[model samples]
Target: MIYFDNGSTSFPKAPGVGEAMANLLATSAFNINRGGYAGAYRVADMVLDTRELVCQLLDWDDPKNVAFSGNITQSLNMLLKGYLKKGDHVVVSSLEHNAVMRPLNQLAELGVSFDAARAEVDGRLPIERVEALIRPETKMVVLTHASNVCGTVLPIEEAAALCRARGLHFVIDAAQTAGVLPLSMKKLGASAIAFTGHKGLLGPQGIGGMLISDDFAKELEPLISGGTGSVSDTEFMPAFLPDRFESGTMNLPGVAGLNAALQYVLKTGTAAIYEAEMALSGRFLAGARALPGVRIVGVDGLEGRVSTVSLDFTPAGLDNAAVAFRLDSEHGVMTRCGMHCAPRAHKTLGTFPQGTVRFAFGHTNTAEEVDICLAALTGMIKGS
Candidate 1:
């Protein structure tokens, strides 16, 4: 089967990811920080190493600032809910996923409001549009590095510069771009960045985290408070970096998988991965552009985008769901269809109600698979 759904989660996770998790479960499986035994100390040390690995991947300096959570959505919620006050305002791009919008909506009910900097029909957000939305009450600006539905890369560095000049906090939702793109927390000048392991990181599900700056970490409150296995004498939570946010038993198995995956990513390098996936994407885009009734969404070419590509089949009088079903059932070509949990992005791209079929290529995918998909799409259009 040809898996083209990497935007949702990676398939054939990085080498040794499964083995790493299984080894922990089969052998040690001891909880960290609570136990005083040798095995527990060994496991805790691995966890600390994983945090350092995350910092290395993101070009962050302090390992203490890295905090793990259930997923990027949870990390985003913790950052947004814990930082914003009732009278504060925020600025966000129109291409954000539900991970950002849902939490902001919840905050809206509590009088914390936000303004969306509109993106062009092609899914690119202008830097000036973001600048125009900032007000005296705007305390933060959150942006997705790329669109989940259309894969258009946003002007995050420009936006970050604007935020820095204006003295506002900057945050990045790197759900689509984290492991795929070369990102540096220090270079981007972002206050924090939320990332998931299951996508480009090629790790197991249920583990994700954030790399936060010292000042921003201080301003944000802990969303959950419990036993941190530190500062046991006091009832209050610890004032340290990770201990302040992490509570209760952590997902040790997930961390094990992520540790192995991060090693693979670092060894292989993100530039190599980007080149491989974009080669497949370019092949698909070149072939699909010639097909009848196929309307390519977002940028027509490969510039300023990731490996993901979205196609609107409405011009052929075909339902997007029906097209995706045929690709999976007949051709064994897996893909994600519809809004992709980012309705605001669809609205911005003018594909709102009908949505589109998303083909998210990965480093594991090959040019031959792209050819098969292109052929499948051609046959579907001809048969129609």
Candidate 2:
């Protein structure tokens, strides 16, 4: 089976990911910072190491600024809820995922408003477009590093610089680009970045985090206040970097898997992985474009995109869902169809109401797999 739905969740997670989780689950049953025992200390060390590993991957200086959460959704919620107050304004891109839209939408009831800078048809957002949306009350600028629906890389650095110049905080949702792209807080000039482990990071689900700059971390409040295993004497939640945000028991097993996966990603290097996936994506795009009735979405080339490629088959009078079903059932090629949780993105791409079928490549996918998928798409079109 060819797995092409890496955008949803990566398949065949890094070699030791599962083993790492299983090892932690089987041998350790200790809660971090709960007690002064060998097992607890060991678990605490693992958690710290995982945070440091994530920091290293993102080129962050302080691991303590990395706060673990259940997923990027939770991280975004924490950031949005903590940072934004009523009567505050922010700017977002047209290609933002629902994760960003939903939370901000909920905040709108309380007076937070945001404007979406129109993204280019090719899925790139220009800094000028974003800057034009800024208002007097604009407190921040949030953008997706890459579009999950169309795989277009946004202008993160340029937009971040705009935010900095305007005295607004810049937050990036690196859901699609985290492990696949070389991310640096200094390079991107981002005040904060939210990431998930299951996708490009090649780790298990239920574990992800947000990396906030020192100053930004200080201003943000914890979404949930509980026993942070620190400052136990007082009922008040600890006001430290991570302890301030991490209020509940940590997901130790997930952190173990993330630790192992981070090691794998660092050792393998994102540059090599990105090169390979782009090669596959370019191959698939080249072959698919040759087939009649296949409409390639987003950028035509790999210059400003990741490995994901969305195809619209309606030109051939085929339903995107039906096409995806056949690709999985008959062609043994798995893919995700419909809006991919980014309805606004689909609308921006002119594939709204009826979304396109997405084929997202991963680190383990190859050119041969791309050929097979291209051939399968041809068969589907011809048979129709």
Model 1: how far residue 308 lies from native, Å: 0.5
lDDT of 1 by residue, 135-164 (tens): 999999999999989889999889889989
Candidate maximizing lDDT:
1
Candidate models: Cα lDDT each: 0.93, 0.91
* Candidate 2 lDDT score at position 384: 50
TM-score of decoy 1:
0.99
Residues 314-342 of candidate 2: C-alpha lDDT, one tens digit per residue: 98888899999998998789999999999
Worst 10 residues of 2 by lDDT: 375-384
Q: How well does candidate 2 match the true structure in TM-score terms?
A: 0.98
Cα TM-score per model: 0.99, 0.98
